[model samples]
Target: MDKSAAQNSAAFLYPPIDPFDQRMLEVGDGHTIYVEQCGNPAGIPVVVLHGGPGGGCSPAMRRYFDPAQYRVILFDQRGCGRSRPHANVDANTTWHLIRDIELIRTTLDIPRWIVFGGSWGATLALAYAQTHPDRAAYLVLRGVFMGTQTELDWFYGGGAGRFFPDLWARFVELIPEAERTDLVTAYHNRLFSGDMLAENRHARRWCNWENALASIETRSPGGESPSDYARAFARLENHYFANGCFFEQDGFLQSNAHTLADVPGTIVQGRYDMICPPKTAWDLSMVWPRGTLTLVPQAGHALSEPGISAELVRVTNTLRSEAVALGL
Candidate 1:
């Protein structure tokens, strides 16, 4: 699973599809989220959640589901993507996101739909499912992340740092030695510092550090992120991580696993995802009665990874067939 080879294999993904319906939905707190739908309007409804808590949705996400079989919905979470007040972290929290998801589901008139998400998106899907298990017909999760303190510490507390010392050192170098102990908070301060220049500078470093390690096969630091995308991404991510994802305690998702027992799910994880390790996915599968885990030995965390994409698309197609058989 050379990076290039993995990418080449992704040629099998569906061609980029345009949304037939798009709109900006107001979800209170002065936050308006960008929402779009593509594929058969009458097809089985499936909402796709992008990563980063700020990654937003991309055209590629539209390609995962069979356009003829799924009515795919994609949206930008609060303060991210094309949402208004770009980079605003005010009133943004995990709970707010869960509410937003509910608002979207209700707004679209969708009773129960398949939920597809990765990384932070997976975390949100889990929370949303736990909150409204009746609304989630099924789930397709990739790069599973539970938004737990332990998972955050593993990636930011020098566990991943130990493996990617070069990039980690650079990430830490941006902060003073004293503040390095809590990099998330240190970055949070700068991301919301109000000084545009300072925020962008720290934002690029924060984003670059994650991008550099996103794919294990290709370890080269990717190109510098655009100032706008970086600022929103870094600020939102830091805002969530710094507050421990706004949860009262760690392992919140696992504690609510029973809520999802009746919901079927597919957990597709990259064996060497540097950003989100496989342990969380493993733990989820063991407890989730109807969840099946598929470990892609040749992929990393990127959704574009060939092995990961192939499995996701395959699962979606499988779900479509099952739904059809059940007359869903």
Candidate 2:
């Protein structure tokens, strides 16, 4: 395994968490969130927002932040993991997730901390920081996808499918050709037909396709499913579709950045990232006045891609160094 793909040794030099470190917080909206923290509590605080809108915590997530230099917090967003709901999408929404992050921050008494998230997580991190700009010290975002219509279109249309012809064929094989051309129709038909079998199949397909994306960028191929991947991914898709991703139009490119200019941000982008094009990162950089963009050419969407993970560690280190310099 490449050292870069592993969490930084300097980051984890401090005693790591116990084998079992999961905890749940109740936010009183029938909402309970699963959370775990590692690293130095006195060091700068850093929160890891897992992608998938549904992707939960991982042991690897702990490596991105220096345990000696950061209070690394990783958690399941609502029903995703360890949380009580178990992928239930009934009362979830984007704004709900935003408040959840803030609620966690307050519950932990963290006045301000760095937010690190990728893909959908990156979108939420930006949205949350934008809404509560004062609460965030900085942001480290990757594989930036800002819940835009074009992005959605790309996912259901030719964007991902064009790259993997065989996978596209398999995906389309799930639906009839007429409906295959209509992405929205296919999702709707499969997601809401009271067909548990079909929905589960759709969820499985979605999960498998995404897993393939992850595998492509992984240094070694291995993963353990908690048996909740489909339910969580489906729930996230269900959550987004319910709110239209809280976008009136192009989310990232629009007036949504009304508060982004007030925040300092750093973006680590994989130049070859196909899942969420690095263009989204470029678009974000132009709006965030105090933003810096680093392009990692040898990367895909996976978290463990070549030097991407090492760079993530570096980002966390830089943030702590900067914050301490600021007397944080």
Candidate 3:
């Protein structure tokens, strides 16, 4: 299909994710998580976990769930959009976020819901499933970020840095020259300093580099991302980093075999995706005995990529079909 035609497809827009679909639920320690519910109430549950440990939901998120087949639940992690304290760091910690996930699921009374997550969401799904295996029916994960030391090493410690020297340089440039070698530390120090201007600018630079890595070709469908997108993007990353991405091992490619060994999963990866790379998905397939790995040769990490979007819709359909096969 042509670009214009593909742009009109269901993946780009559906019932739509309402950024205003917000709810206030008080997590413990005076922290409240912002939750959003979409799709039909009686449909099979598909809980979505957005990236950024901090990127909140977008209307685009609604495209992942078939309105008639799956009930979608979305929420902003601590210190991110809509959630209270707006960049509040007091009780924001990895353990707190993990606990909050369980709390949200329990509150919704979701029994055996399918976990839909990408990037950091994938990591959270694994961790949540590990701690509560019986609660998770299965997982639909894309762009896995395991938070392993190696993955962190690659992103902050110079793996991704090697390719984006200029961005990396700017990240550390604001800090003292003597403290530049440990880029991640310098970045963390400044990013969490509560300097609004510095944090926002730094976040944009970090996101742009990742955005470039995400698409094999231009991923934007038509116009640029919404203006407030930068603020939303920055909020989540900063929250994730400050909170250790809600994991201790720095999660990517860590030993999750035992965690996901029995859980059925489908990993849809874009071969050309430079952001998370294809190996992450490949590695996941190796781990889950029941994982169905689909490689979109023409696509990359961008959800709107022509082939990738189509395949994801198909994956959702297939999962539903399989559920019928299993009499779920």
Best candidate, lDDT? 1
When 1 and 3 are scored with TM-score, the better candidate is 1
In model 3, state the lDDT of residue 183.
57
> Candidate 1 clashing pairs?
none
lDDT values, one for every candidate: 0.88, 0.72, 0.68
In candidate 1, what are the lDDT values of residues 52-128, reduced to their tens digit?
97777888789888898889999999999999778888899999988988899899898888999999999999888
List, residue by residue over 62-181, the lDDT tens digit for candidate 3: 786678777778888877767766656667665677789888888888767788887778777877777777777878777776665556566666666576676556545666888766
Error of 3 at 135 (Å): 1.3
lDDT of 2 by residue, 63-176 (tens): 676566677778888778777677776567777888888888888888888888988788888888878888877888888888877777776677877887777676567788
Between candidates 2 and 3, name the one with more favorable lDDT. 2
The TM-scores of all predictions, comma-separated, are 0.96, 0.88, 0.84
lDDT of 2: 0.72
For model 3, state the Cα shift of residue 323 in Å. 3.1
